[model samples]
Target chain A: MTEAAGTAGPAGSAGAAGVDGPGRPGPRRGRVLEGLRAYGLIAAMWIRSTMAYRTSFVLMTVANFAMTVLDFVAILLMFSQVDALGGWSLAEVAFLYGVSGVSFGLADLAVGSMERLGRRVRDGTLDTLLVRPVPVLAQMAADRFALRRLGRVTQGVLVLVYALVLLDVDWTVAKVLLMPVMLLSGAGIFCAVFVAAAAFQFVAQDASEVANAFTYGGTTMLQYPPTVFAQDLVRGATFVVPLAFVNWLPAGYVLDRPFPLALPEWVAFTPPLVAVACCALAGLAWRAGLRSYRSTGS
Target chain B: MTDGDGAAAGGAAFIELDGVEKVFDVRRKTGFLKRERREVRAVDGLSFTVARGEMVGYIGPNGAGKSTTIKMLTGILTPSGGRLRVAGIDPSRERTRLAHRIGVVFGQRTTLWWDLPLIDSYRLMHRMYRIPDARYRENLDRCVELLQLAELLEVPVRQLSLGQRMRGDIAAALLHDPDVLYLDEPTIGLDVVSKAKVRGFLRDVNAERGTTVLLTTHDLQDIEQLCSRVMVIDHGRLMYDGPLAGLHEVGESERTLVVDLERELPPVEAPAPARVVRVEGPRQWLAFPASASAAGLVAAIAARYPLVDLSVREPDIEAVIAKMYAERASA
Candidate 1:
């Protein structure tokens, strides 16, 4: 029965269908472009869906902006009472806060919906993503693509501009260049933390809270100088989780302040390296998580 | 392609599985802070080859490995053992590549974005699959017309009925012109009209486009109407594989011959092995092997007894499958 049908089947139509034959190597650049296009398409669809309810979208964005502003206000209140925090002037600390806040906000904007990975895993939505021609991480990252989170990023940028005007610094060509690099690498580090933490959901299925502690908590800790925290805690953050590269170590260099742990100034220039290493490790964790995914029974 | 066994043999087997197994490590909490780990072989030593364009029914009891096999075929889950391929691509290894050629729909889940209009989902799929504009338009038009999705295009998926949502999903799967479609219970919760519509559309797709379909459904009529060949799986093993009629014979099933006799007189003398199993008033029912010829038995009954009317009822595929599972359990 199969042979009779096979004689009149998809062999001729396969070409007409425009599917690349098995193992046919399409141009690598073309494949990457296709993946990016798919990601952008999904992200746009989600943004449109969010905009469908205009009132709610506006209210949510405003509420997010208001809520994040309070975080910086608390820092302001702290400086009003004490002349400085951990022996750093209010401007220097504000610089660190702005750096951490902007990077975390950007990371949150990009991958915040990944916090729902555990729920997706439990509900089998992850399976739907796996069958798509696009990369799974790209799909997950763009799953809901919340635009409301941009409010936090906006707040961070405003605070950062405020600190840049307030601080008196000797800016070299390298220091000037390091400013954007620090923010981007800091965001990259936080993005990797989000992905790696969410990957654990494939096994535990309800560990989103555990992931939030690292992502949100790391940003909160980075806002204040590491000098305020105990030495051992600072060491763990630096060597283990590498949250220090996010802003603390680099901000010290930018402010020309002494290192908290009396570490070398050279260590302050390593955010990019740390970000790359964290991302590579996160990539492996995500791959391993996908391979270990036992999709829920139908 | 390096595993060149069947790829060289005319490429007949578009979907092939050889001793494919999926063993899940299920952990159970036996007590407080105590857990036990056990291996549950969802698919055990299963082997089957589906030639291109074959709309085969893959029926099995719940938790009998139907979904697991589909997951493995789609590369959602890797097989613990054995070789499996779809269109000569190792699914788990080149899942994204193979995904360009295969479309899958899970009845219990909607791949369409819930808050978006039905057409929006199709539009997203157009870019996601990188489908050619002309071909996407053609396939979309065909599916819309056949599945009666024109009215539901603008409606949000959350607002559509279950049947309407199901049609939308089927159309979404086809817009890319996939070479194969895996439908897990496509007719699951649909009304009679919707089921018929889906079955007709699938038949046309297979006949016209020659899209190989592996449908797993509980609705036996789905197989009766759409598939010429059916496979019955139980306990991760293929118990039966042949024409739907042959399934009854494998189960040793019997077809009932209900006869309305002229004032039932002592259970009309039926032929050997076709004895009356029940007699009520003037109606008498006889049991005959489903594989037997009912014409000869009907003739003998009419010749001797005053038979007013008679009808031969084909064995129920559902019952035949249940008996197949029962027999396997006992053996």
Candidate 2:
């Protein structure tokens, strides 16, 4: 192409220079970088999209923030009356709740596009994405980002900090460093569940709401001990869906409390594993779904 | 083994097919038996190809595999029986790789971010294509200037005029500077000026970049103005494949001549071999063969009545294509 050969200076020179590099993996690296750049570009577009309807966005976001805070206040009032249920204090319950909240908020940011994106796939609008040189997943991620969700994440951070101050927990350098790890892992776990719920859309005609169990249900379940439920169904859902690892299991470490199960102490330290395993499974499900993509009409 | 050498379904040739088929399973109910699956052959054993750098006008009434063929060529769809390849890579196999080299525009849609400004989409394309910063700026400047997108760049795409949006879509397709471009009705809903501008842009993109372009549209003017070769498809079959000149060559030459007479003419036939088309008031229109017999038809009309004025017109592409389709219909 003339443009490829036409550019001068650094960006062009770097590309040409890499053509004869000593080893391989160069082209793919370029694509990966392109993917990241594409995502950033669309995110900016999303911000502009929000800016277009500034008043509606601001009003709706404020309402959402108010509702989130209201829910937390309701939990606090209920706990004040009962003192403690399922062996968790008000502070401990809040800690688990905050972790789950923040994780789901981050997950919503990363993969929220998937929910409505399935419609694009069904309507054949995804043809625009499939023809691009970038990875479909990257294209899908950048396809459409809803910026108003930031309101929920802000609420999550507020509750998380409150729980940390109210609880009696020993904080160390390693634990502080691992805080980001826990957040990312928790996000990964929830994102996987959301994506899997979206994948069912490939087969279903309507928007698949099954992901609510893992996303909404999972978040609510993690706020307390998994064993608190009388039926094993809730416990099974937590382990199978790995809500325990992302929130409940991690809460055990932060609270330094014994779990209902007689498993070893180290077993409670498994947030990263559960998060990663759920993510890997979801990713595989996504690829399979693409193979079965039946683009409608032309 | 061939359309002469045996045509494969959709693999061996540049655009091949071997019983290339598609069956869509539509499920209306919830249970297993409630699901009803039916086979719709959008492209039933359809097969054809345009060699490198060839400009082919793929035509069909509608849903006769025109888009299906393009989609298969672009690797968006995998044929039930055949394989597809473009630029030496199986489109389905190297879909991501092929994307870098091919450009496509959907006539009824815009590939751009819906709510973003035109320039923003261009900037994102610069990133997606990894255009060097300098080159990005240079190409951006050129396309904006060429497409008259400067004023339109600041406005959001949702707020763009239809003509303006078509220009933006075309500019976006060429941003990466692809080797192949697919246009599905690129000029469907544009004004004459916008359509001409789009056609002109496509012609230059082909000539300047030697980009092999495959376009489908209902506008015959597009074919007349841009494409040197036209391929017509009807009912999922290649009805005609040749040059535009060939389409105009209808086995015999015909020209139309109109004359106004000062007085009514007596009953008279054409002097030599011309045939009278119609007569209204003082004017008479005649169809004459290309054998230089218009003078004879005129002299005969003049002999019967005093002539006021006369002129001859060459057959336009619209009439030529209509006649061609009609002849094909009866034959």
Candidate 3:
């Protein structure tokens, strides 16, 4: 192997980059761009691989679409018994559900591979990721991009459009701009939650259902108006987990509805801040998780 | 005995470890409510060095910290205590940086994407490692040719046979032209042909490319055929580190001399301590200590018996190591 290394060394030195020199820091911007490009290539490969099985891909997408639609149907059935619940109309509830759905779906598509980290760790495959130069999170995400989540995304968009058409809200530029912000930041929050769930595997040796209680259960709870829940539960979700920022708070501004619990109107626009905070916390948790994993490697 | 240029220039081993140790804290459930905690020292104060371009074999029985040492070398697991360096870089502190210089293959599980074609995994690695296009192409072409992977490149990794997949994995590890390659059981579960192919490629890559190799294997033949230097590890300790021939003497193994007598005869009266261990018609087998000179016994046998032909057999590595282990246990 050293003969190849000896020959390859001169070839590598002859190249423009001059091979990983110590303390050279080789163009930070270029490295970031290269990392992004590598991630893109990996993502493309994953898409191609998933596309290899067209029938399964389509079936999974359809199955995902049908499964989420049943939740919407259940909500509709509940509305059939009463004109409105929690002082919000059916369209208003759809608005909340739609936003949460779209954001969660997009986040699921982006970083859902975090859910499989526990399995990978258990099977000793995570060692492969650590060997790579790129960040393990990026590798895991790029390894499995869930295009099937488009099912939930499409349903969210359709429901959101229907709600916008049905409700006559005072459409303002600020409110319109906030829609994407809400969706993206909500997605950011969900992505952070997914990352946190993955980080737990390093601590617990396997992904725990406690993370699901916050992610899946939290998303299910977010689809409804916070007004319907007990004040304490609402407060906990607002302060403890901040799921309110993902849907409840933003829905108030989007629907031109009064803030629940007589909270300040400014709370309706704090999803981006909450999302950023969640991401920061998740990053810290992930780093600690990686440290523990390296030390113990359970 | 020929030191490669890298070791000559640097005047140091490419890999170095001093008093390395790895301890694991494990808790076991003894009963429904009882739990016990214990510290398992997987690697204990072990030390060895491999010069640049040296193909050294690391051999040990299961649970003897072979895999753990490899993991620590690759920075997948941090050592609990010791001084270690690969190419002057601390692996755990600068793992990603070190990744550019080192390549590793774990024979039991693949690093390649199982659902993707073999080439797809290589392509991803090309990007991931930031290999220059020309270099990537050159290395990929070389490995594909040498490993006979042209037909297997398009096959999904999951569909490849174990041997084919192992070959593909070896190629993948070398495609980046890493300075040092760590192979943990690279030929595990491989058939004879596949194993031979892998060994041949490994030899070429080491000799022609001057790439340093640290191979861990259970197959004694792997060590005998490829490694000029071999390290024997047991119970997380370096039991022996020397040439393959030295191991025979250390284990007190025996060399076999099969003598073909001119006719069917009683077991020839052999020299003391060189008595015949087996007899069949006209042939007799003599077992003598491997460290003893074969000339004295052969001359004595020839002077007394009508010997038509005789051949001396070197001690078997398997028996030597097994005896070594038994001796260690008894000691």
Candidate 4:
């Protein structure tokens, strides 16, 4: 494609301007379009390949749909064990679970490729992507989307909406907008964990499943008020590791409850900020892993 | 003019490699936790060139830097020290750009999408090279027809037999219609019929499209059938780089003669005109010196004993190459 651009220019003024002649105004635009070509290619392959196993695809989707109902089962089982162990009401805990369900499911749907990244690297499959003109991250991003994750996302949104109704707070446009931001923030946190796990695979050859502590454990921590957990361990994970951004701080902002850790209402924005930082770090770390792979030929 | 000026005098060579070397430090295992490190030179001080449309057969024993050199040429591995160019394009600096201009086929690897049908991979490659849609269709049709892959277009890659898979792979490489095609053992593991088909297709791709092809195959027939020039590498060094014909005529020990005799040889041997290679039932293998005539050897054998049949055979590539390597080693 770059070569074609070289030819696209005329002999008369070829060296003067790096432009592909005036007749074709889209030459520069074409270069940008080419990078996206690999993404489209992988997505199309993923769709066709996944659809081939029809029964398994449907079963997985159904299992995920059923998986959401387990949240209600947990709450009901817990309520029977005790009226309320923590000071918070059951409805507030349900609200936290709902927001987490929405964000985590969306993260799985959008960035699931990071989970299989170790296997791709081991098999030399990613080598093909490297040889192509596009950046490797873009190609990885384009591969595999789990539409079935809609079950969890939907369940989470429903519980969040119910919690909002029960609380009966005077909601404004800004407050309503904060919900989506937190949801996206939750996604960023999970994706960062995946990226970090994938990056570690370069050194270990196997993905660091410990990263799941931040993702799955982070989700669990989000389902309850942060005050219930001891300040040393859970508090440290929330403050230092920032799982609180996913639910605790954001929940405090939304529920109008006093947060165990002192912070401003601006804490609702923690999810997006931390998520972005994690993503950028993950991207840089992924690139560092790629360089290591090339040097080592592993 | 000096060598540099001389090259400039004749218009720069299509491809050039100057003293390329690659040394890798590998961790060698010692007892248990005590592992020693060693630096293994994969390629060293190698240099060669290919003019436009030249099909050079690169051959070497296993682990003798053949792969390392090819990787350097293809821009996969950066040579520790060298100046290299392919069609005036620096492969390493412009690796991604070079991808569009060249096609690569590793017999052990497949570039096609694993799960997608053959056509889908081709379509994806079409977008990759940005071959205009009409040109993509034209090239796709030509490659498909040439490779006899029209019937197999919808078939997934995993289902194709080794022969069929190789053919599909070659077609995939050409789908982008690259200027240079790097074929690393393109016909390995193929049956006689499939091997012939692959060789025929490659010859045509070179001749018809004027596409420069660099093929590395263990099958010497691949060389004799396709390449005009052969480059032999041994121990990370260029042993020989010239016409295939020149290799056979090394050092005047040329030609072999066979005499079929009806009667057995006498217990006491007579002075022979040529050295005998072997003597089997009704067959006498004789090596004729380049200085001597085959008829002289045959007539002398006939005078000494009754001969049923007589014929002369040009030394095969195996004998020539083996002899070449052996002689180069001792030298």
Judging by TM-score against the true structure, name the best candidate: 1
lDDT of 4 by residue, B1-331 (tens): 1121112312346668888888887887898898899878787788887877778898878888887777767666556777877755555544555566678888878877666688888877776566789888888898788789889999887788899889998988887777788899998999998999898899999998878888887888899899999988888899888887777666344677877778767321324646777877677777766556676666666797877887898667666777877888798
What are the per-residue Cα lDDT tens digits for candidate 2 across B161-199?
888998898888888777778999999989989998888
TM-score of chain A of 4: 0.80
Fnat for each predicted structure, in order: 0.42, 0.35, 0.39, 0.17
Instruction: Give the alpha carbon lDDT tens digit for every residue of A1-298 in model 3.
Output: 1110001111222233323323434344443454466568778887888888999999999999999899799999999999898998999988988999899888888887777888888889888777776656666766687688889899888888888888898989989899999999999999999888889877776555777888888889988888899999988988888888898888897787887668898887889999999998987777678767877766
Q: After superposition, which runs of candidate 1 have C-alpha atoms over 4 Å from their true positions? A: A1-33, A294-298, B4-10, B257-286, B293-312
lDDT order, best first, reads 1, 3, 4, 2
Higher-scoring candidate on TM-score, 1 or 2: 1
Query: Which one is best on lDDT?
Result: 1
In angstroms, give how far residue B263 of model 2 lies from its true place: 9.8
Worst 10 residues of 3 chain A by lDDT: A1-10
lDDT per residue as tens, model 2, A140-170: 7765677778777888899999998998789
TM-score of 1: 0.90
Each model's chain A TM-score: 0.88, 0.83, 0.87, 0.80
